[model samples]
Target chain A: MTELEFDYLRAYLKQRSGLALTPEKRYLVESRLTPVCRRFGLATLRDLVGTLKVARDSAIEKAVVEAMTTNETFFFRDRTPFDLFRDVLLPQAMARRAGQRRLRIWCAAASTGQEPYSLAILLQEAGVKLAGWQVEIVATDLSTEVIEKGKLGLYSHFEVQRGLPVQWLLKYFTQIGEQWQIAPSLRSMVDYRPLNLLNGFEALGTFDVIYCRNVLIYFDTPTKADILGRLADRLGPEGALLLGAAETVIGLTDRLSPNPQHRGLYGVAAPVVRAASPVAPPVSQLRVAAR
Target chain B: MTNDPAETRTCLVVDDSAVIRKVARRIIETLGFAVTEAEDGSDALLRCAEAMPDVILLDWNMPNVDGYAFLQALRQRPGGTGPKILFCTTENDVGAIARALRAGADEYIMKPFDRDILTAKLEQVGVVQADAA
Candidate 1:
């Protein structure tokens, strides 16, 4: 592809998906979009760009954006966030929302539903604490393809092996042929939607906990700050936000602040009484839980 | 798999397929394990008798003393239950997987696994440190 064509593609991707592709990523653009070209019956990147220049085919554009985005994910990925959810976040929510009896969680970049499903399993394990409570897990991703897959709640044997505890596997998923299907009860817990973070989420209302992990790293600093600011807007007064292990709110936005006690946890930049904070379970108990 | 006395953790890769065993050994070794290889369940039992490994990657459908029998035999032994057993096979049936778990297998691993998958399973079974992976 010519430099001009690459520039146009880069600008288009940035505008549509907030993907800030550097000049060196021209090869990545070619490799990822090449399949989209074939799928859309375009002969080459030149033809694809030509189509984009003219009145664009919505399907082709969607394919291009989805191709550029990576959806690599698995259940209970990174491990610690889930632990924090069980050990800290849940107890806090239980105490804070005891009167309301409602808890809402938003997974901003919930790729293929694992993050939300894992959270749902934890809620299921929470048992009596959440017995009659109304819980809503809103899982959103940019790709409609993944959203459809997430709705099905089916996973391969290989996919389930990643980061999923064996006992949880047996309890939460039923094997079908060569794949496993999430339990219908757990599958119903999450409401999956296709959402671009650059767009508005005001209609979805506020959330008690927001997980916008790993997705921000692809965006430029401005885009990251904008998304973080909006995420903070969606969070409740005492709600929590968890980022990817490598991501943080510092230097990006002042709307959210890091919890001194937690590593990747963030919340609205205010001094809120953490009266509901519970002691983390013993290390031995966590080790046993991992098994 | 080689017995490296200097290595603190030991893993026995038991598979009839040399390729699978070799692949699993290479992957497990990276997780700070001294790997040892056994072709079938009988051979694995002998290896366990010599010096029980901290982890066993057992394969089903072996030539003699298949994985299920080996698991049953191992659990019956005095120090057999000490080693964390990960049942590895191409069998994807739900019944079979539950059976293995019931037979004292610590975890289950599907075939065609890579380094990441092996590491995840090992971490799940506590053979490798979770953060270490």
Candidate 2:
């Protein structure tokens, strides 16, 4: 692939998805897109880029974007986040939303559904606390292929073995030939949708908890700030956001702040000026802001 | 399991395959454990009788007292229940996994595992810290 073709593909991917590919990642684009070129019967990366420039084939464009997006995820990946959800998030959500008896979680960039399905298993385990509660897990990813796979809830032996606890595997999955299929109940618990983080999410409604882990590290600084601000808008008043262990909001955006009690947990940041003020706001102003 | 002044944890890797034992040993040792290798379940049992390990990575199918039989016997021995047993096998059947769990295996590991899978399994069973992995 020439420099021009690489640049076009990089910009195309950035616009379609929020993947900010660095110059060093040129090889990654070439390697990942070579198979895509072959799959589409194109001769080389140059030919693929030429076709994408015309924008004639939506299928090829979709394939190129999907090829560039990383879908690395596992059941209960980075166990601490899941532990925090069960031990901290659930109890807090229960106490704050007892009147509503409803909890909605959004797993943004939910590659192959492992993250959301893991949460479903936890919710199942919390049967007593969540009794009679209306629970919903909205799982979305940039790749439609992964979303479809997630909807099927089928995983290979190797896939199931990664980070999934043995008891949960035996309890929640049925072995068919060599692959394991997650229980239908758990599969149904998550509503999988193909979504690009660059696009709007107001249609999905607000969420009590949003898991946008690992996906933010791929975006540029401005994109990270934009996404973080939008994510804060989607969060309910008492909602919490969990990012990947390696990610942080310190340099990204002021819309969300880290939960002091927990390291990886984040929530919407209060307005800096108002929060710092010594005097209390009037009840009328507070009620108006609530609306 | 006995610890030296350094307090390194002990792990017993039991497998008929020398390659797997070596790989597991290399991975476990990085997690601050002194790893010992045995060819099969009978040899593993002898190792346990001499001095118990903190964790055992037991192969399911082996000659002369298979993993299941050895696990049953181990649980019955004095201070046998002290070690965390992780049943490692190619068997992906739920019934087989449930059987192993019932036989007192603390966790399960599928065959052809890499360092990450081994580390994750060890962390799940509390044999290794998450940060250490």
Clashing pairs in model 2, backbone N/Cα/C closer than 3 A: none
The C-alpha lDDT values of all candidates are: 0.90, 0.90
Off by over 4 Å in 1: A271-291, B1-7
DockQ of 2: 0.73
**Candidate 2: what lDDT?**
0.90
Q: Return the TM-score for candidate 1, rounded to 2 decimals.
A: 0.92
On the 0 to 100 scale, the lDDT of residue A28 in model 2 is 96
Candidate 2 chain A weakest lDDT stretch, 10 residues: A271-280
